[model samples]
Target: MRGCRYQACRHEPLVVVYEDNVVDRNKKRWRRNNEELPVHLRRPEVVRPSRPLSVDQWNQFAWESSQASLVPCENCGRTFAPDRLEVHQRSCKTPLPGAPRKLALQQVN
Candidate 1:
């Protein structure tokens, strides 16, 4: 029988017997009672889906892709040299309201 994936689950097989039925020993592990439980109930750390981008947003990305290295970040709209572009892309702290945080998240491990 396959054990439960959860570290907390101490679940064991439930043995059921019928009066007129012959035991089907060939059958494997029984299904868990909580198999149909909601995902939130099963896993606590669920990430929500991000909002969908509009057609204009896609067009902007496409336009940016066609541009040369002389182009700057769409968020900051500051032109930078090709060599400096990657570094600037990672560290630029533009004051734009909707712009994503410039700094990447530090990995704990």
Candidate 2:
């Protein structure tokens, strides 16, 4: 077989892991929902079930997030959410040297 590229079986059932040190294939993509995981493993970006915040703090977060979403991409000059920026950047085709990437980013940011 030339360059046999068989990926791991995805149909297999996900297994719950307790130990942090041990490498569990299932837990690599997502942490166990029911049980507590390591500090690093927990995704802090998730807003739901997060710590309580003051009205001011919530308002600031909302405004800042909205502003960030409106910021345009340096390469494409099209606005996209911060999370989608990385994906868009990958597919976006950068123009020739004559086209200014820095200027667009500066104006948007």
Candidate 2 wrongly placed segments (more than 4 Å): 1-65, 100-104
lDDT of 1 by residue, 1-109 (tens): 5555743353332222442133332221111312344332221222222666688976666555434224345446665544455678788665667655333221111
- Give the range of the ten consecutive residues with the poorest summed lDDT in model 2: 7-16
Compute each candidate's TM-score over C-alphas.
0.23, 0.31
- lDDT score, candidate 1: 0.42
Task: Report the C-alpha lDDT of model 2 over 1-109, residue by residue, as the tens digit.
Answer: 4343332342232232333335454444434541354342233332422688799988888876566435467676776654466678899898787775655466745
Q: How far is 85's C-alpha from truth in model 2 (Å)?
A: 0.8
Backbone clashes in model 1, listed as residue pairs? none
lDDT of each: 0.42, 0.55
- Model 1, position 81, has a per-residue lDDT of 41
